[model samples]
Target: MEETSSATMKAAVGKDYGEIRDMVEVVDDQPRPGTPREGYLVVKVLACALAPGDNRVLSGRTKMVQGPPAFPYVIGGDVCGVVHEVGENVEGFKPGDCVVARFFTAGPRGGLAEYYEVKATLTEHKPKTLTPVEAASLASSGTSAYIAVENTIKEGQSVLVLGGGGGVGTMLVQLAKRKKPSFLAVTTAAPKVVQDLGVADHVINYEQENWWEVAEITDQAPFDVIIDLGQGVSAWKVARKYNLLKSRGQFLTFVGDHHVLWAQGIFQIFQSMGPPLWRSAWTPCIPGVPTFRWQLDGLPDKREPLTNLFKLVDEGGLRVVLSNGSPFPFTTDGVQSAMEQLATRKAHGKVVVKVAEE
Candidate 1:
């Protein structure tokens, strides 16, 4: 082994909470990007996205997780960056690879700072189809929607997507169509936009109408799949309305009590029902999807996830919509703006805090 020096960088910390602005600070002494092995890779962070989840955490939604945590709790998730170094034994990726990955939840700090580690399995080849920012947004948000819609849905079945204009909701629409579901219904703040996605056969505005009624779901027929991206009361209303197992229907949702959602640990209690159904009975998550070594090489190239997702996008099954404005992106100083956007409950797509490439 040879000796190497670690580098320092700037980062924003989640020091306690009254508000994000008061809490986040640019801290020094951060680790420089470095590789752990010849095959291991490190990324010099280009950007990290701030979403409602990040905002909620900053604004004392700590009950959703392990704690109020601590001061200087760095906040940010999802990233796209250039490869800083590759360990001696590393195979394909080189020092200059421009890659994108969902690196936040799996590690300590995320794409917020200038650097972080990259797992080969989860990393994609960054198609000429997307930019770093777009890739960062897609890696996590897009992937979640893809999994929820594609993995859970069957071909030619009608589906309902609640909270349908947000980030994951948009992806859900795109991926759902790729499955070639026969009919699509959506409940969102923006009715026209969801319809424009081409996957939605019907779009109901959450503000002016009852999504269930407009979808004609309750009286007409039940949906085969329901994707919920929002949480609490409203989500329950939709879940209870149409979850029919005999019809082989299921509900897939990402928003819930994070404190209870530990690695899908809650599934053990539901064992009597059989392997946990994500949102709907029809859509079963891939078993043994997460493993100790899965991240090291990025999401598997040979695995069906990437290839399936790409095919969907190529077929116009997946799309990325941008919020190109202030208050659209979540940030520290922009806490009030972030909160206002989420609180108004008006956004139709993913709201992100843009960190770089202004």
Candidate 2:
């Protein structure tokens, strides 16, 4: 195992909760991760991908749910890097092996640093066909997309992805296409980008037209599956109002109308959880209505999903979509710019920060 010579490392850190630009800064003196504990590996991070959730943690928007931010909180979760040290009980990984991992730590520390400690269970060998940045994009978003597609998509089913341009959404579109859906449609502002993928049968520009009102989309109404990635609409209400789902159809959401949660304070957010739970549990009782579900939790085991996702990638069935000006340098300004782009919710694809040279 190669050992880091220094006891400290440079990291993009959130000193306190407020704004990404204000709170995120690079520091050279942050303590470097030491030896891994059992079932863990200490990784020398090469690149990290930014997600909307990182903004929530840094901005104190989800403080009530996630607790207060730890001072000098690192600001990334999806990481791709080389394994530096493997702890006891860890197998199939060794020092110098390139890997990708998702760190689900409290306060969300680890990814942005020069070194991070991650569980072996959540880590996987990076596909040779993908760069570190591309591999980094998969750990979280790909896992979510894989699980959603596995659970909801089936051959000959009709699928619609609301907001299909972000990190998770783009991957979802690709994964859903592999399922050989009878019809695949996506609502996205980046119509050109999504259309270029050639996976979706219809790309409705939500910015230019109301997706539900569009004849092409509505004509394909009563979809078998609708996956919402927070496109500023009440997916459940829309599904019910427009009769968008077939009987026993499934409605899955990573986040439903997050603007309400962001605009309203902590109490409102906590209060909002109730209705989803109620609906997810009881909505099926009604005839002809789709089942409501919230996909907020991470999969308990990611190995199989990641293995399948990587195999698909190796076959050229999937690829990471990088936003403009991505592969941002590992600096304060670079990370701030990346996070700022992510906060806008307008990035065509994944925003990534290159932490070190591969």
Candidate 3:
């Protein structure tokens, strides 16, 4: 990696876990771009997005499945940028290549700065059609949704996506749409957006009425797959009570309960395979049900899944839906507003923060 003269870079620092305003501040003390170590590269971030997971960590609500982040952290994991520096041992990537990266598991402080350092394995070449902001918005959320669809959803199956207005939800809906499902439904506050965007065949306004009570939704029970992005207890209970899922159906959730995280973390402090072990061991025993959480720990490399996502985008088969009037400027105020909109749970598709000009 070549040297840059600048000694500091601007970053959004989380002083302590709390409110958005209290937690995040734009500061100039962040270290300048670093020389890449072996198998790593430094990126000049053009865009970074705010995911719900980012706020969960900022508010001290994250369950610490792997480990907790230190105080005064930098927040954000999704990044779309140009390779500014390449490590000695890296291959297939060089300086000036446009790439996308997901660093949620890397550490607490990540892409929400002028420059970010990440391993080569976690980065992917960006598709030509996607701008930096669009690519940033797709990183972690897109990868997870794509993998879930590939693993669980099948063509001609009926599908349900809870919380379909957010980042991962939007991607899940689009991926499922591509499969030509017999029936496709999504729970979102903004039904018009889903309809206008043609992302789902059925749109249930979760705010207007309970999902189970909606005749349009109840009529389509026993769906072959239900991807629960909302993680609402009531909705989960309703699905079980109404037999909304088929016998061989799959119910997958990435946002498991915080209590589960607490248990996982506490037990891990003593034994390595503790709560997560129990979860994996016991979840499959329930009679006549197929349920599983998105497994981040010990997961295989995401190259295949991410490559498929890029192909979808390049082929014009996938569309990224942004929240209404977004692509928020990269400023303290812009980031704060983005987090607040996500907290409202009414955002239409993903919310992205434009970090810098491409």
* TM-scores for the candidates: 0.74, 0.95, 0.88
All models: lDDT? 0.56, 0.84, 0.75
Candidate 1's error at 41, in angstroms?
Answer: 2.0
Clashes of each: 36, 0, 0
Q: Runs in model 1 with CA error above 4 Å? A: 1-6, 27-29, 37-39, 59-71, 104-108, 215-220, 231-246, 257-317, 326-347, 352-358
Model 1: per-residue lDDT, tens digit, 44-71?
A: 6665554555655566533333233455
How far residue 208's Cα lies from its native spot in candidate 1, in Å, is: 0.8
Model 1, residue 154: C-alpha shift (Å): 0.6
| Candidate 3, 258-334: lDDT as tens digits | 22233235544334334434544555687676564444423345566777789889989677888865788667888
Of the candidates numbered 1 and 2, which has the greater TM-score value?
A: 2
- How do the candidates rank by lDDT, highest first? 2, 3, 1
